[model samples]
Target chain A: MTTGVRRRMGVEERRQQLIGVALELFSRRSPDEVSIDEIASAAGISRPLVYHYFPGKLSLYEAALKRASDDLAARFVEPREGPLGARLLRVMGRFFDFVDEHGPGFSALMRGGPAVGSSTTNALIDAVRQAAYVQILSHLDVQDPPARLELVIRSWISLAESTALIWLDGRRIPRAELEKQLVHDFAALAAVSAAYDEEMGALLRRILKDEPADGPFADLVGRIVALAS
Target chain B: MTTGVRRRMGVEERRQQLIGVALELFSRRSPDEVSIDEIASAAGISRPLVYHYFPGKLSLYEAALKRASDDLAARFVEPREGPLGARLLRVMGRFFDFVDEHGPGFSALMRGGPAVGSSTTNALIDAVRQAAYVQILSHLDVQDPPARLELVIRSWISLAESTALIWLDGRRIPRAELEKQLVHDFAALAAVSAAYDEEMGALLRRILKDEPADGPFADLVGRIVALAS
Candidate 1:
């Protein structure tokens, strides 16, 4: 291919190239340790070309984080018909697998950068967290006590985040054991929230069984419960 | 005082000066962002003189983190008294106060450096976390089913950490409103734990009313039920 033609391939391809290499470098060192020059060199491109794709290091970091978040969100949104508990386990298992595979990038995104103000990193973390929150809230059928539902959703995310961090720290716990503990912990926490009283649990079961098939709220709630059981 | 006499301060005073200035810098920037020179200069001492007090930057960071953690622990560990709910609220209040006063330093220590691998930052974080964990566990009076008690303690800390982050992230809710919501949320969560069942709640009430100095666990149980109910 001609050099000009190769250079003009497409924005999407170049974006992916930058993101892939950036993830690799970020995973190896802290964000502050990785420079634009290093990313461009690692990607087999010039520094100017890297800038042509991403305005700056912060933008590139955000884009890389978004890419990872998108991948994670996709796993949860994928079509799956099963009991809520089973569905949640499948989703969490996928999450843990992703962490095992890309521990550094995930850790960097979650821990965030202290030197960098909480602008981009906070937005990304919030987006990912909201995705999980929406997944859990969509499952419940109760109409009263909105704050209670919010608390449950928040607690669920807290449990998952803490467990993921603990595992990622590599404290010598076997992956299998860690996953098992997380599943148990999640299920127990969910069971309590789902059944504040027997009435609530029954209502939740009904809602899950016969969720309406239309409207934005319906879709949102359906997705949440589908992953939360 | 003569210049020589002024330069020869007691060891405790010098150590305190180093920790105080280190915390100030850490609050404004990441531990990695603040250099030894900056810390020393900010404290009105030469870099070499600063090194005479602490081995290096990492040691200075660790010392600051340790002091903050120790102060927090001291505030949280109360003498045994009152209902479990009351006691828990008091302890939770202390935690909230600490965050309000030392958020920057705490954030620096928790989110500053690589979470894992060989680093003094990680060691300091681990030490603080373990100390907090022990303080929490010591407050619990789990006489049976140790596993359930473990779950309760983990869940409590999870709630506290999540709430603290949310508050720090600048939620629109008023501080009083947020604290109220947190107390309610934590109480409900603690109530659901195995130790706070209906039978135990009744027993705790009896112990609080009649027992003289009902020990740490008894005080904790009574306080948890009081706040939750």
Candidate 2:
């Protein structure tokens, strides 16, 4: 929250400061709409000094994206305790909190394809996805997830991204409800994948073993069975 | 497929031809990468004539986008018969077929921000979404679906878009399997929404009444119940 002029810092610290400033600005507006001069002024520095760190707006934008990606990746590192559903809810809470903080930049970085759709941009974005994938596996205690589990995880990530965008865009339901909806869909996806892959079925069973009777996963099972009966 | 010299046509039909040629060109690359001469050449027409129909490249791109949106909107209109699962599969088939035919264009139009992001562009894209919403309501035989049902429908459409992009981005998974996965998710989403709303629950119950006992929906329910036991 501190934006006032600070004492002279080392080169690495200065670069981080400028990139952090740029990330906050880019988080609200598109990269093209932001100017290097604006970023410099926002950081309590001169334009030339900003150029000394990043040659141009694109370089600065890339750094900002990388910084944001790193920050988001860090959020996925929740403790791998409790039921998988609880751990996932913790991760998703942080995930949605990040979305709430960095709305536009998250959309651009997460759904890379036009303004920041370069190969470099994609690598930065993929790094965040890779972090989430690894975090999910850690929660499942699966050092090597089966191929089907991997596919469903990737699909669930896509579902989460799209769901976030939709939920954010509409602001229809409360954030807690949106988080609960994600947990429900993820559990249902695990169940659906279970029909095809025994490993996934086993994983779902193992995770649900710790689930309380009145938990979201149990309710999902209950509601689904209600429809069948 | 005929692109050679053609007989003179009326103003509307000729405009359609130019737009069609532009669509094919845009399908392969972004609008910025595509040129007016290339579109004219592909249509066996002159640059001036291309401008005669559309004032400039932006206008032509917008027109082509409108055309593609209309084509995509048309694909979601499936007959309201059989189980909802079966009907959704047919619509998804045509939807994915459109994605296959207009791959790059579909990505640009559906994920509109950066490449084709504008108030006008957003309106066109939302029109396609609006069409799909109405189409789904018709399939459900619900003139006024519950608000939660509306949210899930919108979420499913977004999921379909992201899923198509991911599935296309990595051709590791076969398209048929991807399509099946979409149908499965769509059904699960419907069931999940059912748990939150009375109308959705009833709508789902009616849909499942006609759903085959061994179909994906029943299988999902059976698996979830397996965890309950």
Candidate 3:
């Protein structure tokens, strides 16, 4: 390849570049509002060149959504070293970081994508939820989570999604506070379930056993106890 | 009045009847799958007669959704006599009753309606959420809810919605348990918020002060305290 000769982009590189351009545009406005022409222009390529990479706008939208889903799922990952509460706080912080950066795209993803009854869109969304669920389970070090545990995990995931969605509407609440509150919400959800079931109680105790006094879970305990005073 | 002859339904009554029939059909299936003919046939009338009442299927669907929204909002209402937990449990029971009877319709409503960019549908759905929020605030007996209190209430409403939506998928969890669990989830969410904000903490204590020992809120406190032991 000649140096600085405007080297021709490889087929895969060009496709990735187009997806990046589309995703950036989509992050600003809903996918329905962003046109393929705008995407092509933003990429500094002709409309036909864009079409050459992807079949249609819907297809391109799905590709961009897939990329976002992966980015979101990765946000849920954290090292298993720290206490679970601190780990979750970090995870939530990163999770909101993505939301803060990609407000419209995150909203669209939570709303199940724009207008199309695409199974691909549904699967991508479900994949992100499942990824978060599995990561939480891994943190718990459980081989098989009981029904109530599963319920708590799944419900908390939904809470986080809705909380972020609502927060995106003007984001009236400070992002940092919401992030810390989400971590506490997870603990509260699990604690309530633990109050009901023996299995959940045991699970909650085990999880709380290793938590530091300054951790979110312990902070919740201290706050609840203070109420009794 | 002609004796022993079929009486024509008054226009208002007939319109209400058509909406009832359409809502029944939409409850069994999504609004998208139900048609104008079905509504007319269900009402023992002709298609033209159905069109005489409502201009089109979308209009009929909107009418039906309006009725369902009213019914759903009604489910959240409770007498303020009992402890808040018990009151909330009864409300959740009725709420799930609606979800149980109208699983598909509930799912569609939660998913923001089927295939149409109908602002009416959106408005009706939002009306239900707003009604639920207002009802919850009333149950708390707060004149001016603090920001954190508002967040807890809104987030809990969203949680209840998503929990029901997930449960409808397979009916895997027992409805009664889920109902009770939802009451616990609300207390848990509020308690966590209370831990952080003074306004929320005061509100939570006031609410819990009225709760009985056997009530869900106290049960949650007992469970969390047991873990500490």
Candidate 4:
């Protein structure tokens, strides 16, 4: 019934909107540099209005951190059907998209910089990493994977994150090329992991079946085989 | 020179002493949190004395960064007389020492946190990485390496950097295991690169001569051979 300058909004919508504004501001600067007044003005609302939604700046920041981490976790999810290579390419493509869209925010969220205030935000970021790890494991057809496979995958995830940060910070390579390279790196890491663990070795063989025999992955596999021989 | 409370310290010594104090402070807290007063008091000097050696906190911070890079570069230059694996283990051991000793300083320097101020500090950090790249290249016994070899080493270096940050940020694994794992990862990365580049492949074969059959490296090579078959 009310749709005017003083339009009514639900509590969740208002809270989410405030978080969106904070996230936008935070994406550009560290949390310390962002004042309550700046966040309010950026949101096109009064300062008190911002405080009304969130008691303090740190609370607002935590909300933004949640929003970003949730978005990143959602991006890692892709359909498990198709060649693993194709699926990985598509999933990595989405990851880069998030980086492109959330430039500074991406940096802030990933760095969780020295400016980070509390352990709550740190835990929130850790949850994001864990969630990504779980999603990566979901691709494998195992409920209880061996410890080494889990470690390798987790290490690969860290590699992916650092590589993305460098690519964004330096614009080192084209996004398409970077995506393919990361996928190749992941495959290579798995193959390398296979070098020491029977279970991981089997896992690589299982995954390789879902990949075609003639791309960067095939080239990598060919070289690995040549080295072995 | 007068030997009293106002004894004259050489320009270089005074500057270095100030940096020493700043580095200690920075190792414990992020740059934003460390005030000039704390830096001054920590060094047993006055605030003006700090300003005398450096223009501001940022300059002091930059100097500390330069010190870290120099010390780290020095660490990586182990005697080239030993077997490459032993040498790398030694070099990586120093790296881990830096990671352990520097702690938050290492995190701040590598993360280049969202609160990062000027590009000068960044350029200094980049120079450190470039120096590392050169040092790593030196160990390869190649004056002019192929692009792929360079990429693999560089990527490995990034992996090393991120792993250090994560290890410090969270005691994910014990330092000894993490060091061995990283060294293995570098060797594995090189092997993966070898799969794509014959020269790198040859390099791997050459290096394997120094490794014993009972070690992790041998196990990895065996698995790689198994994959090839």
Candidate 5:
């Protein structure tokens, strides 16, 4: 867009555009490395104009993080469809797509501890996690999960999070394999828990009954039985 | 243990005593909430004397963290005898023991991100994780792990770390159950990787062969198979 169009932008529109610019810059590098002048230039706006929207860099960073957190939470959304495994695999795809696209930004947000003692950043991280947990539970169609099931879901969420963070360190493993493996990991975690608890067992059986012979959950069983043979 | 005997302690002894005292206080409460006067009084020494050992609170906090990190690493040590599952369970027991005893301190160390912009604290955290990784690899008896195996190990490590941190929040679940579940998590994670890769499959076979039917690993397999039937 021309500078004329940029100047005529509405107040909220300009604020959002500035946040988008800051996020784009922050994604390429650590937020600490990006400055207000750089963000203003990237947005085709002046330094003073950037200040008009955000009081300072920390405010801008948090705003950017809030947006990123929302985006990350949205990635966990998947339509209820055929098999739980297939749906989960799609969810992981979108989740990792966010990770893959926002490598440095994601790392900085997850790793930097977000402004050192800033509860806001921690809350944002927790919000994303809580969102993912809720989304998965909704997919499971459970109103209130048993304790063991909760542990499995929370543990798997942690696994998926750390797996993505570590994967970004070098991208050593193929993106697709990690994605599928994560879905399998979820089933594996739940299966192990189900084996020990009656409620979890009932839950697993219910989930498995809905899974098809060629679905991801059944495929995990197939591989295990193959190993036994 | 008398104050008279404490006064007779040597320079190194006094320094060690100070660190120990600081750790004890830090363990019960966040480091920021604890002060030099508190540490000094806890150690039965003058505040200046406490400064004689540590340059400042930050230095003292780092020192206490160093000791905690070393102790944490030591918990991963296991005799090369029993089945891997039993050994892992024991390790998790000790790991959780540390988490249980140092509730606020562990939270501070793991969740607080240490000093703002302090690489020292981050490095200490990484060192603990690395130490755990090496110890587990030695237990697996693998000199050079395949990519998938590495992923499993690293992912499991992250899982255990996050599980413990989450558990410390309210600790609604029994500590003993979580300890056992973490070991099972390792097996579940590794088993899933084995299902997907030949090298990991062979590694699983090797591990299973050594595991008694009553071992945790075998118990996991039994659980999965039981779910299928």
Candidate 6:
């Protein structure tokens, strides 16, 4: 870890290092509070090197956010074959685990003010949510008016996101208990949605593919499908 | 308003004045950034007089929060005799309206940081949420397990809260569109849960309550009940 060792690295490796350090500092302090000079000093690099990596603080923030988004999406889209409910439960479990491990960074991402008018994060979140909806609709074997699926998908996403917020606030519910409750709760919602006509279900499945699934979402897709069907 | 009338007042009037000024300031800036002296200066009162009304900044913050919470709860819990869906929608609409009008204050209450700890604000928000759950549950016409009722109530609250957060971000979905989507979504979830077991159907009805014989939610609830049954 000596600063004296100046080793050259591949572009991808250097890019990842910058994101990792930026996320670390951003999690500990506000975006405005952390300066480019501090990042450069901490990384043992010259100011020009930092500038070459990111033109400005805003660009650096976006790049960090993109890494986080990509990481989350990758986890969510992992292949799983099983009943929608089972698969969804597994996915959600993974999501919660990730959040617990990376609580500070996740908090920074969520609680940071207004994404500076960048719709990138919101779009990414929405894409993941859509994936869960598609997984649920497909599992449930629903095919009907698109609106019904939209309703069901939105309902599930709301439940999952709210639950995660509560959990993050240090509620004392055990991990097992939380998982059981989520499954039960989601299953109940899915069952209700399944009664709607099939057209909405089909439309929802389409939206699912349009969005990349990742981050704090677990097997939400399958559970949603099970409930819708 | 006159800046320095210096009219002597009783304890109650003085206390009211302090709270009014504090809330005005807190709404405009973070609670941590605002100070007692600034509040006193704004209200045109002596520092000692402000202290006489409240012991310290934290206490004053709690008092202002309590006042806002009480007002919010009152608005959300008003009686509405209609179908379960319509009544629930009315409650949600009022909630969104309150958030829109009091964006800064409401955001402070909801997004308060770790520095704020768990203030009375949280308890107050929880109470209002519970009240909404009770109102929604009252319309249901079912005798089911307590756990099932809890599931429905939790899911509904989650949906309502999440929607409010998104709406607070200034995403401009029309009220009609939001309501329609919510009703359809909740209905689908209710139908799916009911199909899981007769008990779940009873739970869904109990949570949504029975719609008036000819009200808007009557057909929606009936259709859901039919699907689940």
Task: Give the candidate number with the greatest lDDT.
Answer: 5
Kindly list the interface RMSD, in angstroms, of each predicted candidate in the order they appear. Answer: 11.3, 3.8, 2.7, 5.0, 2.2, 8.8
TM-score of chain A for the candidates in order shown: 0.75, 0.90, 0.94, 0.88, 0.94, 0.70
Which residue ranges in model 1 land beyond 4 Å of their true spot? A1-5, A78-80, A114-116, A141-145, A190-229, B1-71, B79-90, B96-130, B137-156, B164-229
Q: Of the true contacts between chains A and B, what fraction does model 4 have?
A: 0.34
Candidate 4: pairs in clash:
none
Q: What DockQ does every candidate get?
A: 0.12, 0.30, 0.46, 0.23, 0.59, 0.12
Q: Against the hidden reference, what TM-scores do the models get?
A: 0.57, 0.78, 0.88, 0.67, 0.93, 0.55
**lDDT tens per residue, model 6, A74-165:** 66653545445456667778778766755655654554443432445555566666666665665555554254345545666767665665
Candidate 5 CAPRI assessment class: medium
Interface RMSD of 1: 11.3
Give per-residue CA lDDT, model 1, range B1-229, as digits (tens).
5547748988889889889988878766656678888988887778998998898876787788777767876876776655554566677777878877776555544433432222455555556566656765555554442433444455557666766655665543345444544444443334333222344344334434443354433333343222222
Show the colliding residue pairs in model 3.
none
lDDT of each: 0.60, 0.77, 0.82, 0.74, 0.85, 0.60
Model 3 chain A lowest lDDT segment of ten: A1-10
Between the candidate structures 4 and 5, which one is better when assessed by lDDT? 5
Which 10 consecutive positions of candidate 1 chain A have the poorest summed lDDT?
A: A220-229
Q: Any idea what lDDT model 2 has?
A: 0.77
Model 6 CAPRI rating: incorrect
lDDT per residue as tens, model 4, A12-115: 88788889988888877656678999988776778998889999987898888888888988988888887777777888999898887777766755554433
Please report the TM-score between candidate 4 and the true structure.
0.67
Better of 3 and 6 by TM-score: 3
lDDT of 5 by residue, B1-229 (tens): 6878988999888888888989899999987899899999998999999888888988888888899999999989999988888999999999999999899988876665446336777778889989999998999899897778778888898888878887888886788988888888888888788888888999988988888888877777877998987
List the candidates ranked by TM-score, beginning with the highest. 5, 3, 2, 4, 1, 6
- Taking the tens digit of each residue's C-alpha lDDT, what string does model 5 give over A21-90? 8888988887878989999899877899888889998888889889998998987888887788899999
